[model samples]
Target: MRSSMTLFSTRTLPLISAALFAFSFSASAQATVVDLGVANGYSAFIFGNIGSSGSSGFTSVGGSIAAGGNIYLDNYNVGTNKKPGSAVNSMVAGGNLNTGWGTLSGSAVYGVSNPNATLTAPQWFPTNNISKGNASTLDFAGAKQQLTTLSGDVAKLQSNGTVISQYGNMTLVGNVNADVNIFNIDASNLHNLTLDLSSLKSTASIIINGTATNITMSGGFDNFASFANRTLFNFANATTTSLQNVGINGSILAPNAAFSGSGDMNGTLIANSVSSINYGHVAMNGSGFNTVNVSAVPEPGTYAMLLAGLGVLAFMRRRTPARAPQAAMA
Candidate 1:
């Protein structure tokens, strides 16, 4: 009896305690995740430069802009769609800000002192929206690392939605009840696709991971703007990603891809470089890529602990002797 009690205390109890603790911790703890770190606030977060496509001289942005390289602009208007109380700088250039003429609704910061000699500087609207600073405002190098990691991480998620290809068109349908709806598509098959998100909940996030070397999103993705705030398009393996004519709804996460387009991108634009772009609008839905955790899965070690605890209880039960029957006399 003493031996059994000792076993229960020394081995079984600890195992059971550990198992319960691990399981409880795993069940209660949840990781709160955000898509982009500091880059989320920008209309365009480019690792390289932001230049005009030579076709359109008027480039407008609804939010703040950040670039690792130079910002070459002929006629740029920024911070048009920003919140009235937003105090952040409208432009943060890691290299230089070369502009012939433009108006910034907010302050500007640049790394290089000298802009293009042809233009003195970009005009600041409201007169009070002028704040000049050096290049230490934003960490572009750090943003590059985080953006690359996000691209790869989002791609690893298993697809929960179906990508149906029929009649030379692709259709994406998602489960409305699901917290996250993931879709995987190749650049080859994503032509004239329609976003059937009528069933999806407004708060649920949608992740579209595209695999290709060179990807062009044009004509497809009708009505993507309505769900753009809750959507993220991750092009992890692309070297070049271009948008043409159509209005882009979601944020583009292409860390290695050179982003160019004559279209209007309405969400957070993260890429290696952006050139010849037309419009970069801040996420319209307000909450860009909102993700919520509905359930939690225990870790491998936690499962092992639980199993071990149950096994010990079973072993102890088998080892213990049964109590003999006693007769009562009247």
Candidate 2:
């Protein structure tokens, strides 16, 4: 009886351990999805801190603009003023605004000017629900921390006429002569990866082919484009990102760095701050890619089921009869 009981315990323990491990892993993976919180409202552009110097441009933002810091729009247009369709979106600022010579044609501008004042504030100035100096709705700190937890591979390519480097289910294809570095990542095979090009020249064009995967890029690119929508370019580890007259296409997730350049970008921009001289455009995606939805951990019922299963296995082991004592060995 004792021998049989021991055998049962040994076999069942391994199975129970495996089951527990699988369940935990699944839960952790599901939890990686992060919620963008209030940042989701402004699809076009969102920034946490805008320096006192501010920005100036005539570019158009397709969606809304939400700023957690002071907005210095000295000489810029915030909406469309074309011939037939002369319309503007909403602009919400959490801090003060130094509206020098800029013109806002949006439906409303919140957190700026007093509602009852007679001064000729921008159209729809001091809209309702305008909160000033309030905390940002987006969880900047949480998002940065989440990026650190992501794991992936790193691929480096040397541009010598035609550079080709493959690493861990990802391929880099580009012509060094044309100064183009393209990354073709297999999203299904490799979920997380980073392209380190800090050592390469900044004149190279960087392109990414995967969407909705964990990917990060270090160093600067003269031109950047993405074929996949909802692709996130995390620059959280870098202190600053400089785009010198380069136009990029993709969402930038830089919670800690400041973006400074005289270039233009088409896609959502979530960063600590932004400073631009020329036309800098950040167009938000309406496909719900700018925001994330993090799922909660597995429910208590899941844990209960695992415990119950282990308990039943133990009970069965006790009930099983031990093999009869074998005859004395020769």
Model 2, CA-based lDDT: 0.45
Quantify all predictions' global Cα lDDT against the true fold.
0.69, 0.45
Lowest summed lDDT across 10 adjacent residues in model 2 is found at 151-160
Model 1 regions more than 4 Å off: 1-32, 52-58, 84-87, 112-132, 277-330
Candidate 1 positional error at 155, Å:
2.3
Point out the worst 10-residue segment of candidate 1 by lDDT.
Answer: 280-289
> What does each candidate score in C-alpha RMSD?
5.1, 11.7
Candidate 1 yields a Cα-based lDDT of 0.69
Candidate 2 residue lDDT tens string, 130-233: 33322334343454354333312112222223223344323333444433443544332222233344433445544343332333332233323432233445
What TM-score does candidate 1 reach? 0.75
The C-alpha TM-scores of every prediction are 0.75, 0.51
